[model samples]
Target: MSNTVVNSAGAGLVRAVPALVGAAGFALVYLVSGSISSAFASSPAPQPNVSGEETRAWLIENATASAVQAVLMLVSVAFLALFVGAVAAITRSADGPARRWAIAAGTAAVASMIISAVLSLLVGGLAAGLTPDAVVALRTANFIAGGTAHVALFGLFALAASRIPGMSRPVRIFAIVVAVIAVGSLASLAIYYASILILAGRLLGMVWCVFAAISLARRLKQFPPA
Candidate 1:
């Protein structure tokens, strides 16, 4: 390849650095949030079908922690959004289905976060004023948005990344698996025990992001300008 092509590829890799950082940030912040919330809790948080009074008391008692968790989630979502946009740019520069797939993935990724984001703000900022019944309702909605729905839509990103023409076999296969786990997590909506799928998809998606970003950088470096 010519020096010009090499330089272009190098520039692409540099531009991709944000996506790498964003992916890492998304995972790290989310982990920290979970850890902090768990650390402060005296008992396991209430689940769906728990009494509204019990849920309300739990929220009120943990109001500060809930706010902190919400703030962290917002930050993580911002990082994930950055990752989606940056990766989409990289895919758009490549040939084949990558471009279209990335766009769809990016769209889904952002859309998935909207409900979670809005609900987070409400839970964090308005928990004190919420009725017991409202607490139960919001809590369920929060779980659905941040848990199942988020990962289900995020699976599209993994699926799209898997299609990038020159991605390594392992990364592509892993991305596909992550996508399946993530998209399949939708089953949890009906079969409550299947929430394990949501957990797997959410956590594995982070790992996939890191690997995919590295693979994307490597692929960009290897390919020359047409």
Candidate 2:
């Protein structure tokens, strides 16, 4: 097999590991939190006679889910690192529009990772003092930074992946859709549901990441080690 194929395969494998892991983490957090929210909505409002212990217990229970979300957040950062590494490795073969996009995507990945780390640190510091308003403010910032990064990185990935030889047409089309979604999500940031839109965009972005990894892996397998 050729060097191109080998490189692509390695990149793909590296990329896939984090994506699958992150997706699992995301699913776990989503399910747990959504369930809790549903339960809370269905339950009766607190009675005037309710004890302090009961309230504390409720908070503790919610905290458990929050802890799970924190773990998922860290896993997501790991995935971003893997994505950046894969893009760096594959960018060498890219030229023209593809090369430019790779560079931009790699840079955005790095920025996104950095911002995520910062947000995590901030949340940890404020965890004890967290109120609904404070959480909303922090989450707003996180969504803005995260959404911008996703748009930049995914847009680049779509452009670069579309140019790669042997990549399937469907993968290219998916990339295009991801790029469009990212842009639209960014535009929607001015609205109250920005977080929701951004989350949706990131989910779509994950699909593109998986496609990229598979394509790169297939290329790599076609090329053997020298």
Candidate 3:
């Protein structure tokens, strides 16, 4: 029983650490980016319309913050890889469909995180030095990648978790709720181009991580030590 507790603790860490790191990254993005936008723009704060030179200046001025954000995102994703392992470990006791969905969800999420980190890093480096058109192009890449894959994959994860007969009802039900939110998030992005919706989705996604981690930890507690 002690062994089970210890291993469950480890699995909990595996899930929680990445979500925490990722949360920190998002917080930094909001703080750093929001400040930069306000600093560079006039009243009304339509930052998306701010000039490329201003954007470049902010990137250069806050180079360290930009660097930190990139590092935090990368760190988050790295631990996210461990979270994948945790999910896989849990799936060993789950049915075939649950296992398959879990793997697919993990793969998609890992891919999204990698893409988000790499593109954002590249844009941060290049946007500050490039032409206006070039800056626009870079920003476009930054905007477009995650809607189809990232949140959708999370919805898929929710479905898989709900199907896992081993988990408790509240856990499964919450998974389904989160899946619905994920779908709404995607629809908001697709139909209205609402960036705030995306933000809400991601924020809720982290919350889901916390709850799912707890659920998975409980499941892991039932595992016998090898």
Q: Output the number of the TM-score-best candidate.
A: 1
User: Judged by lDDT, which candidate is best?
Assistant: 1
What are the per-residue Cα lDDT tens digits for candidate 2 across 1-226?
A: 6999888656657644544444344334433544554453324323213443443343344544434444455555465555655544544444456656665775675477457546645654554566645554555555456555655565656556565554567878887777776666665645645545556656776666666666655565432332
Steric clash pairs (candidate 2): 1-223, 2-223, 5-219, 5-220, 6-220, 8-216, 9-217, 9-220
lDDT of 3 by residue, 92-124 (tens): 655577867877886777678668657667766
For residues 1-226, could you state the per-residue lDDT of candidate 1 as single tens digits?
6999988767777877987988898889888887887766666677766888887787777766676677778888888888887776666547577757766776766666667767866865676788877877887898888888889878877877677776689987897899899999999889988999998998999998888777777776544444
Model 3: lDDT of residue 124? 68
C-alpha lDDT values of all predictions: 0.78, 0.54, 0.60
TM-score of each: 0.86, 0.60, 0.71
- In order of listing, the candidates' clash counts read 0, 8, 0
Question: Which residue pairs in model 3 clash with each other?
Answer: none
* Candidate 2 residue 11 C-alpha distance from true site, Å: 13
| Regions more than 4 Å wrong, model 3 | 1-54, 146-148, 188-193, 221-226
